[model samples]
Target: MSPLPLHAVAIGDGLTDPATQVLTKPQQAFAFGLVDEKQLAQAQALAQEAHDLALAQRYADAADKRSAMEDLVPLGARNLPEA
Candidate 1:
């Protein structure tokens, strides 16, 4: 079958491409035929990649929020107000 990108094809065994590594996990898997998806189109696979990326961002955001509330950051010197 012809490749989706039309230019990212890798021939022969034991060969690798830097371009492939740059692709998202789903994209790489789909491109390399790691998963059976005869009914799945490349566009749909790309959409799945988008979905996964969005989900990853959510996890990262949660981690960021937790870090913000944690004592991981060092507090600088300050003065106390008179009581």
Candidate 2:
């Protein structure tokens, strides 16, 4: 016989309850500095562009969004050891 669906067991355990999935702790942001005003502007422009792109593609699938979101990470957080 085919194995029972694993998700079937989870249904009775309040797995779908919104309260059971409440956040105990949410992430706080990390702080950093940019190299200069030019870099800061570059980062801001990148963010605005990403925001606009997401807005324009608001109906796109989640996988496309996951790909689009890689740019959302600030450059300092990405390439620098610390910033």
For all candidates in order, the CA lDDT equals 0.35, 0.35
TM per prediction:
0.22, 0.34
Clashing pairs in 1: none
lDDT of 1: 0.35
- Residues 1-83 of candidate 2 have per-residue lDDT tens digits of 99876764433433242221211101111234423455444444444444454456542442243333323445444432211
Candidate 1 lDDT over 40-80, as tens digits, reads 24424443444444456654544343333222222331111
